[model samples]
Target: MSDSTQLARQVVQALLDAGVREAVLAPGSRNAPLSFALLAADRAGALRLHTRIDERSAGFLALGLARTSGRPVAVSCTSGTAVANLAPAALEAHHEHLPWIAVTADRPLRLRGTSANQTTEQVGLLPRAEVLDLAAGDEVDVPVGALLAARGPVHLNVQFDEPLTPVDDWVPRPTTARPPAPASTPEPKVLARGPRTVVVAGDGAGPAARLLAEQAGWPLLAEPSSGARAGSHAVPAYRVLLGTELAAEVERVVVAGHPTLSRPVARLLGREDVEVVDLAPDDRWQPRPFPVVDSAPVWRVGDGAPDLEWLDRWREAGRSLAARVRALLRAEGDVTPHEVAGVVAGAVGARDLLFVGPSNPVRDLDLMMTPPPVDRSARVVANRGLAGIDGVVSSAIGAALAHGAEGRTIALMGDVTFLHDQGGLVLGPHEPRPNLTLVVVNDDGGSIFSLLEQGGADHAHAFERLFGTPHGVDLAALCAATRTPHWRVESVAELEHALSQPAGGIEVVEVRVRRDNRREIDERVRNLRP
Candidate 1:
């Protein structure tokens, strides 16, 4: 067999041994050998193969698979701009600590700086990831094994010579599995019981924060993607409360994960009067501008029960705010973005998986998603690292495929976000389709900006053209073009009905609302008092 063919097979076998069950590939001439190897592996039932015409979508699809599966996922593409297209997904994976392996095909060393057809500096294309530059005859076992052992994303740039095709009937050998890494000891820090503390859980915090809060009888301010948002102590209207006088009374804050959603939370952490304790894992820590009094892997409050009165106070305030907000939403008469988010949250059961897009949809979910009841929990995911509104559709599709065969997958996004990665909806006839329901809140444009400073009356002159950027493409027609099922709902009841149906394949349910009331609604919400 040719050197390139042998190297490709070895690399694929190594990935399989590393426990990569899903692989996504983007087509190009340079990566033909790797493509053939991946197909062969799929035929052997070693891994599942997904093919995408767009490298960007393919990268996110792989990211989604890894995110939901809690296992490394491999994504391969040709050289040049195709490798660059994976940058967004790579950055996200690195920040979120997801296991993603990027395999890029490149020309041999002889083609360096020689005006090759699809050549660029592919070695350092993804600076955040550990890049492994390989040639045809180089040993692949060590580098591939190292990448598999690493926690985050890794890039493998392989150089192939003129003949990119594999030799006929070359079968890969069975891979040897490596022993699992040793688990780390949990060093729990003892927190002082005197101070009134609240647990702040951000993206990727998992359930540790929630468990700590429940045990300590402390209020939990968890972002929607935290997975710790449920439970009795979770404060639903934390954003508003953070801006209230009650937040001023906070004596200490225990933080987990990375909180980037609200300015109020940032301000709260910045307060010199309130001490902050961060319980982020060792590998995840980075220096921050805000002061953190203590940092550890786990934190345990000192003996004795926490002040139940303080917890009750915050819980009561949260309940009052939730009731007022619900009344206000009902008073609106027509369906609003907040209502749409609430209905979607209600529809999500313990077995369901939800991927929320960035911007207003995620923020709305943060504000409105009711805490799941006891004996039930839903896995909520969002790409909050850098938090850009790209690749969300493909990411959602990937999450759906990896989540399970029984549970339903739902994606909540705004019109602009949906349009940003509309290519995600395009699936080949032979490709695997997941049971996904995309809930799109269509307000004719970028309504999220309308709630920001850009929507002020003073900037109304430049608002519509610059920020709104309305693309009046009928979403139903867009769904039709992609051959996906589409539904348009205008009321809360209709949205609930739409979500109630079993999701068989990819589909879109568009919820229409007006953008004019966004600023007013936001002001009212922020100014609300218990």
Candidate 2:
């Protein structure tokens, strides 16, 4: 057997042994050996194979698969630009702490500085990820094991010579070695119950934040993607509340995960009067502008709970604010972004998974999504790491595939975001398609910028051309071209009905709305009261 083939087989075997169930491949000549090995592994029923022509899409697809499955996933591509394309997804994996194995094929070391056509510095290409350089004869077990242990994005730049083909079929052996036990986290810190505190659960804060809030009788200001945003303590109108007088009364804030969504929360953290206690999993503090009074692995309540009156005050104001916002939403004659987000959130079941796109859709969800019943909460995932709108469609597909047949997966993205990675829709007929329903809010342009300072009267002259980069691509035609089902929903009822139907294979449901009223709607929301 060829050395390249042997090395590829060994690496694939190591990955499978380390419990990698899914892998994505971007075709190239130098990576042929690895591709063959991956195919063999797929045929052996050891792993599933996903193929994408675009390396960027492939990387994000692997990211989504790993994010949902809670298992490591591998993404392999050829040398130079192909490997470089995986950087955005790799960076997201690094910040989100999702386990991803980046396997890049490289020319042998001798070709490093010798004018190789498809060669560049591929070893440390992903600065945030742990890098492992492998030659034909290098031991594969250690690096693979280390990647499994790190539980984040890891790079394996495997150098292959000419003859990149497998001579014999290789079957992977199941790993007998048990995964190492997770390190014991410190007990939740017992906080004094005297202060008027609220739990701020951000990004991957999970359910621990909700439990802490419920136990302490404090309100939970959880971001839409926080996973802890279902319980009664979860304040639905948190952003609005943060802008109100209620936020000014806050004496202390308990933070979990990284809060990067709203300026109000950032301002609250920056206040010298407010005592901040952070419960970040890692040593790095999230609220950098202000000093954290206490930083710990987890936080527990003391024997006493916070004043019930204080909790009641926040809850009452939040309930009132939410009612007003809903009233305003009801006044809108046609379907709006807020209504679309609400319908999407309401349609998702406990067993379902929703991948929210980065831009406006996620923010709309944050503002308007009715908190689901605690027992029936759907899992919400977002690319909040870098929060870029790239590869959202592919990510959603990957999440759906990882979720399998039992659960449905929905991706909520704006028209601009959907257009950004439309390449994700280009799946071959032979590839395994997921049960994904993509709900796109078609605003015709970048409406998100309209709500920002860029859309102010001062910048109105240059707004449409510069910030609002409108594309006139027909989404239905795009879906038709890809052979995916497409539905255009005009009303909330139509959207709800579309979401209620049995979802199988890939499909697109476009919700069209106007970009002109976005600024007005945002203003009305901010000005709303009980």
Candidate 3:
């Protein structure tokens, strides 16, 4: 038996033993041993395997799987550029503190710096991850230990020699029970309750944020992906309300997770006047960008309850703002991005899984969706760590597949984001398909920029060329190529109907809207006050 084959088999088994339930592979010559081993494991029902042609998409795909399943997912790809393509996902995982194992196959050590093909410093490709560079003779046990201790992303760059294929039919041994990933001990901190405060919950803030708000009787300004966005304390259209007079009265702000969605939230955090108490702590490389008056890894509500009048003010403001925004949207008299987001949000149930892309879609969701009174079981996810439009579709698909067979999965992304990872739709016939409904807001261009400073009247000329890049791609034809079901809706009625009857397997509903009025609508929405 070849050492390459033996190494690959042991690594695969070790990965399984280390709690990797899902594995993503981007095919290449150097990784043939790992691929063969993985395929054999899949055949024997040892773990689920996903295959992607694009290394970038494969990386994000593993990201979704790891996040939704709450399990460490392994993404393996060939040497050099293929390994580098995973940087975006790896960086995101690092910041988000997700357990992602990147198993990169590299050329043998003898090929280093000798003008070898596809061998450009694979060891340090992902600096954010805990990396272990291993050769053919290296022990797999130490690397497996790193995988077990991985709090965030981990990299295993293994070098394999020629004869990458297995010589014998490798039958898998019964794998041991996988251990649970260790949870961080909650750093206890008691926050004094007299000050007028609001709990700001960002992406992955979890239920602690909501519990604190409810217990302390404070308003919850939670972004959609925060998981704490529900409950009675949640304020609808909170971002818009942040500019109101009520927001100015905020004496203190209790923060959790990484809040990066809106400028208003950033402004609130950036305020040197407002004492920002953090619960997320400095988990990643960079500390919190804003001033942290107090820091804790996790928290609970302190001794006394806050004033009810403060909470009531936020509640009334939220209701008023939501009403005003709803009226304004109705007055638009045309199908808009916010309306589409609202329609999609309304379709969410307790058993549903929602994956939102960065940019406009996430913002639209924040503005339009009303949080439920109680915490619904619906899970919302986004790649907000770096907040870039890379591999969103592939990540959503990966999330949906790993989310199990119990509930429907819905993904909201803009046309450009959809185009960014369109290769994710190119699934092979033998690949496992997830029941996913992808809703694309086709504005023909990047509408999110239109709402930014770049869309100002003075910058109109350069905007279209750079920021407002309109791509007139026929999405229906694109969907046709993958044999995926597609629907194009232009009206709220049409959108509601389309969302109701999602084409079961893998489908897309493209809602067409115009970006010319984007800035206008945003300005009007901002002007709204409680």
lDDT of 2 at 154: 93
* Local accuracy of candidate 1 as per-residue lDDT tens digits, 1-530: 78888778878877878878899999999998899999998888778999999999999999899999988999999999999999999999888888999999999999979988989989889859998888877566536568557777899888888678865875556665564687787767888777888999999898999999998899999998998999899988888888788888899999888888888899998999999988774355478557988888877878997899999999999989988888888998989999899988988888989999999999898899878765576889999877998799999999999986768999999999999999999889999999999999999899888887889999999999999988898999889998999999989999999999855899999999989898898899999999
Candidate 1 overall Cα lDDT vs. reference? 0.88
lDDT of 2: 0.88
Give per-residue lDDT, candidate 3, residue 37. 94
TM-score of each: 0.97, 0.97, 0.97
lDDT string, candidate 3, 1-530, tens digits: 78888888888888988877789999999999999999998988989899999999999999999889888899999998999999999998888788898888988888999989887888777968888877676455535666776778899888899888877888678877456566868657778887889999998888989988998999999999999988889999999999988888888999988788899999988887799988666566347788888887766676764688989989888989999998999898889999988888888888889999989999999999899866464788999988999999999999899886878999999999999999999999999999999999999999988888888999998999999888889999999999989999889999888888877888999999988999999999999998
Name the regions of candidate 3 deviating beyond 4 angstroms. 138-142, 180-187, 375-377
How does model 1 score by TM-score? 0.97
Q: After superposition, how far is residue 162 of candidate 3 from its true place, in Å?
A: 1.6
Off by over 4 Å in 1: 175-179, 281-285
Number of colliding residue pairs in model 2: 0
* Candidate 1 clash pair list: none
Model 3 residue 190 distance off true place after TM-score fit, in angstroms? 1.8
lDDT of 1 at 284: 50
Q: Give the Å shift of residue 39 in candidate 3.
A: 0.8
What range of 10 consecutive residues in model 2 has the weakest lDDT sum?
Answer: 281-290
Q: List the residue pairs that clash in candidate 3.
A: none
